[model samples]
Target: MLKVTPNPPVTEPASITDPTSPYECPDSKKFNEAAERALDYYLGPPTARIMAAPYCPNRLYMTNPKSSNESLLVDASETLGSANVMLNDFAALLEGTHRKTLLGIAQIVMLGELAVNQVLDNLVPTE
Candidate 1:
């Protein structure tokens, strides 16, 4: 008896954007718009996804003495810039730093748990 192999599904490039072709969405041009939104969310304003429109820098930008007291889980403070900048500076410090005195470590852990739950929920939804 011969085993039958299933054919690979074909994706319509006409409906998809070619990575090299620069935002060409054959659909309704919505994909292009969405791609730009995603990029802007990461690279443009409200970078933390927590700030309002004006995007004024928050207290997190200020020096936290806790930084001196305890080692951060991701200690890249020596190399400061946007990438290392926390999701919401204080937000991560509250959650990631091993510093016992810092606020919101519990909250950060809760949020992380919720995010993980969301992923798992997507994979195994209740019937």
Candidate 2:
């Protein structure tokens, strides 16, 4: 009778009975230290990073930090007034619902301007 499969190879058992742990190896300790360094490099410190000041995206038209509150209010009021006038002019050129919508926006801007002016009037000038 012929055999269908080959016989398995016989091998001798190890003379030493104890198996060594990977952590006990000198190369494994170096690998562990390298892994720790990589982790520390990728992940920053435990504490949250603090910013000195808030970041501003636009550098072109930034308000002066030293400008007085009254001056800032006046600038805002003037801008709102100009916007209201432009809206009204544009509204005059249109007809029907579009004109009404533009006029509504203009009225809101005018209200803002009036509120700012009132605040300015109430504000006492600082010497």
Reference-based lDDT, residue 4, model 1? 100
lDDT of 1: 0.53
Off by over 4 Å in 1: 1-103
Instruction: Give lDDT tens digits, candidate 1, residues 12-57.
Output: 6744645665545555477778888899888886646765556566
Task: Give one digit per residue, the lDDT tens place, for model 2 in 85-126.
Answer: 999999999999999999999999999999999999889554
Instruction: Give TM-scores for every candidate, taking all chains together and pairing residue i with residue i.
Output: 0.21, 0.56
Q: What is the C-alpha lDDT of each candidate?
A: 0.53, 0.83
* Model 1 lDDT-worst window of ten: 73-82
**TM-score, structure 2 vs. true:** 0.56
Name the top TM-score candidate: 2
Off by over 4 Å in 2: 1-47, 51-58, 125-127
Q: Count the backbone clashes (under 3 Å) in each candidate.
A: 0, 0
